[model samples]
Target chain A: MKSLAELQAIKDKMKDKVVLREGTGEIRVVVGMATCGIAAGARPVLNAFVEGVNKENLSDKVTVSQTGCIGICQYEPVVEVFEAGKEKVTYVKMNAEKAAQVIESHLKNGNVIEKYTIGANQ
Target chain B: MKELSLNILDIAGNSVKAGATKVGITITETDETLSLVFRDNGCGMTKEQVENVTDPFFTTRTTRNVGLGIPFLKLAAEQTGGSFSIESATKEENPGNHGTTTTAFFYKNNIDFTPLGDVISTVTTLIMGSPGIDWVFTHTYGEKETRIDTSEIRAVLGDDVPLDSYEVIEWIKSSLEEEYDSFYK
Candidate 1:
């Protein structure tokens, strides 16, 4: 029951924030979407990141993409955030709700959610 | 995958990796069945490769020992009491190099077949990830139908517009949404 008018309004309102991703130092959020990841619920997680970034108006600052196996099938539905210079942060066992939290706390607030990070266990 | 659109995306990603310059996707929803077809002019698999593609233990990638996309799709189809198939001719197998075709059909009455997810996202993501690849998408329901060709859009927008731009993406999404909206009406 969604409408195109809604999407058009978003395009008009955020016209200025479009970031040309060519070395703009934009943050990259990659979802592991290979066979394992997809089977383990990566689609909703990917969708969450995409919708969250757009809703939060962080599209210019963050790029959402998908990648092949991250070599960790047990921790399926993995999401990795790569900032300009910081070490990449990998979040495992992610779901849609947790993805929204990542977008809000880590991406917007500039504070990594340590509890969700790969280092949480370490 | 929990959504049919997501499965389509994953399977099409394989076509992209096969060095396909173009991928044609067809979705037809009728009163009795929903069918999906993906045809790609890519470096196709050999018979041996095709035989093992649906096996969870087999994969061509060294990064992982299992390939789940095709196998999952097959399971989904069978679970719905539908059918699935993939056929391809390797470049060397033929002179003109006909490529791969993957197809799936699900009975409309089947409860296990996942509903088509956000198709607009699946399509735009395909275009964004593989720039310069032409995508011919066709959707049909009942007597109504719509077709979108990326090549045509590119011609209209010219070089001044990047296909992945926010405006372009919204435009494509809106157009598709509009078409589908009218179909259901």
Candidate 2:
């Protein structure tokens, strides 16, 4: 079992990392979390984004947040990525694995993972 | 839900959606039963609303018109030979007050009862996720017990220190884990 001591360590390590990224980021990562989204297992996908962004040290460039339904309940857990001045990319039926790949390929490398996008399914 | 903490989050999210300023959550474990209760000073439901909540098709959220948190909780408890219930004090009916209370009992000794998940995660996430809302959480394991009230944290935090601040979130997690340790460890 994990302990309080571990949480303390995380704070000490993340202080400068999270605070510095407060407003300078232009890339937005949004996870849908309405009842439909949550029941479809969006929690892990959301956690993956929060942890993955911090792990990749992209907090300085990306902002992670949650939102209610995007009106497409059947395709949840949906993740949308919005870059400044660019069209939003909606990724449907997401899981932890795909979230990780998005962070690595799209967030860090600047190349969108096409198959994960809504267009791929359409 | 995979974990009790997630269930807590889901239910509390409903509290938040209902416009609750203060939410109370209690968890107890004994030789006979393991139970959880969530009470919130939010918008209380009508009798019709409460009765229909068990019908998987009912939902208040306009997002997609589906609700499952309460129904699943009722099912989870009943499946284990335990019981589940919901009570509400509607302001319209009561005149002076309003809120919703949900309770679930799971016989600890039952073969189908699920294990209590990481509760530290439960309380911390509740606080971290909703900085504006106040939370009171009580946990009991056997004869030992622990209570955490965010108002106390708020008094120390003052106005400038946000509950969602990096350090505060860390401290809340540490303190909650320590408290849980006192009961179970």
Best by TM-score: 1
Name the regions of candidate 1 deviating beyond 4 angstroms.
A1-23, A51-61
Interface RMSD per candidate (angstroms): 5.2, 5.4
Backbone atom clashes (below 3 Å) for every candidate: 0, 0
What is the Cα root-mean-square deviation between model 1 and the actual structure?
3.7
Taking the tens digit of each residue's C-alpha lDDT, what string does model 1 give over B30-53? Answer: 887989999999999999999999
State each model's C-alpha RMSD to the native: 3.7, 3.7
Pairs that clash in candidate 1: none
lDDT (tens digit, per residue) of candidate 2 on B1-185: 66666677778888888888999999888878878999998888999998898887788876555778888778778878999999987778875678899999988777777676766665765676677888988888887888778877765555545566546665776676766666766
Predictions in order: lDDT: 0.81, 0.78
lDDT for model 2 comes to 0.78
Q: In angstroms, give how far residue A8 of model 2 lies from its true place.
A: 12
Give per-residue CA lDDT, model 1, range A6-113, as digits (tens).
Answer: 544555554444434332537999999876787788877987887788777777678888788899888888999999878999999899999999998999998998
